[model samples]
Target: MAAKGLILLLFFSGLVSSNVEKTIFLAPEAREIAHDAVLLGRRLPVLTPSNWSLRTKIDAEFPTEGSSQGKVSWFFLDNLTEYQRYEVRICWAATQPTAFTLKTYEPSVAWEQPDLRASIERFVPNSQQQDIRTGVAEPTSDQPRISSALVLQVSAAADYFTKNATLMSNVPLVDVDVVLDPYILNVFPRSLLPNAACIVLVAIGSFFVSRWVIALIDGLLRADAALEKKQQ
Candidate 1:
């Protein structure tokens, strides 16, 4: 009886040791940009230039309903020569659990001209020009051009876990799935980008092999125990 129990324990231990699973996670960095534009019928020039950036955070839970969540923070700057106009848009996405996506839109424009007569003409010739002919003749190539910039920040997280004891613990198999989310950050130079989404499937077909290994060990231990019992 003792020998039989010993053999069974050894067999089950081997099965557990061979059934462990492995998983992976990722954390990405933020992105930034800079430039100029016109907003609401006003020309906004980047006097000191504009800047943009983004940051992201994520949390994931395994094998449960409503188990994952994420948050993204974004920032933007628009420098003006005098006064100018501008607009902004923001978007977010997730690739796991249920695949969630969101977007925010904001538009702004301003106009500010310099005080100096020469500076005013050099900076904003269109604002100084009175007649269409002088405006048309004054080297149109160097006309007060508008420049702007934007920044985008994103944060993300995920959770994943698998249980083998529930079903077909002795079988080998593989499975995979992917999710996606997309958003726009601006209207004029419309931003359209895709989020990551992919699934991988893998199965260990060593169930029968494991069972046989257990049987072999059990047979050896049983034989040794029988011999000992006989000797006693």
Candidate 2:
């Protein structure tokens, strides 16, 4: 269903939409990344930028919905060549539980290369496997902008690498997995350092000013009373 929605979006827009005019709860860094993705989406021929919005459809993880597991995954197979290196980055919204897992799948021996029609089925997450590696957590939220990341070093087998040593060595692969919170992107940290310094100064100033104002008012009232008694 998620795939279908993405396809429909591509089809309707003809891959020429100016911007995805939608809001979601994303962390500051994630929000910036998302904006960059949208900008890239507007320019790129492929669907790298709009991937996060599509994943939000699966569950509630955007600005509107605050709960549930929202997921987004992308593959870089379309542009892969026999003598090329690749890097992939994946980002998603963070959820309440805060648990994250990453799984890596390698290509099979029978997977043929050099054929233009060849399909790369190398990235399939194993659902039956109980043990999935835990990802490193990078909390980006002060309130709810927390996110996580996992770096995946993807390459062909040793035999394949030996055969194409020149091709593999020339290019490096980088993959980024980020789960973001759309709501907390703009939330400021509530710490008592430099941020609180301004507030604290303002508070002290207000406190003295208020005290002086009240004292003046009280003094005026007492003076008025004394004048009234003298007249009496």
The Cα error of candidate 1 at residue 179, in Å, is 9.4
Q: Which candidate comes out best when scored by lDDT?
A: 2
Give the Cα RMSD of candidate 1: 23.2
True-vs-predicted CA distance for residue 76, candidate 1, Å: 20
**Stretches of candidate 1 above 4 Å error?**
1-203, 230-232
lDDT of 1 by residue, 1-232 (tens): 9999999999877654421111111111221211121221122111122222222222222222432333222222333222222323222222222222222111121123222222213324332331111111212232333333222221222232347454322221111111111122222221222212111111233666688899999999999999999999
Candidate 2 residue spans exceeding 4 A from truth: 1-192
Clashes (backbone N, CA, C under 3 Å), per candidate, total 42, 14
Q: What is the per-residue lDDT of model 2 for residues 1-85, given as tens digits with 9 covering 90 to 100?
A: 9999999988877544231111122211221223222221222112122232112111112211421222322221111122222
**TM-score for candidate 2, residues paired by index:** 0.23
lDDT of 2 at 7: 90
The 0-to-1 C-alpha lDDT of every candidate, in the order given, reads: 0.28, 0.29
TM-score of 1: 0.17
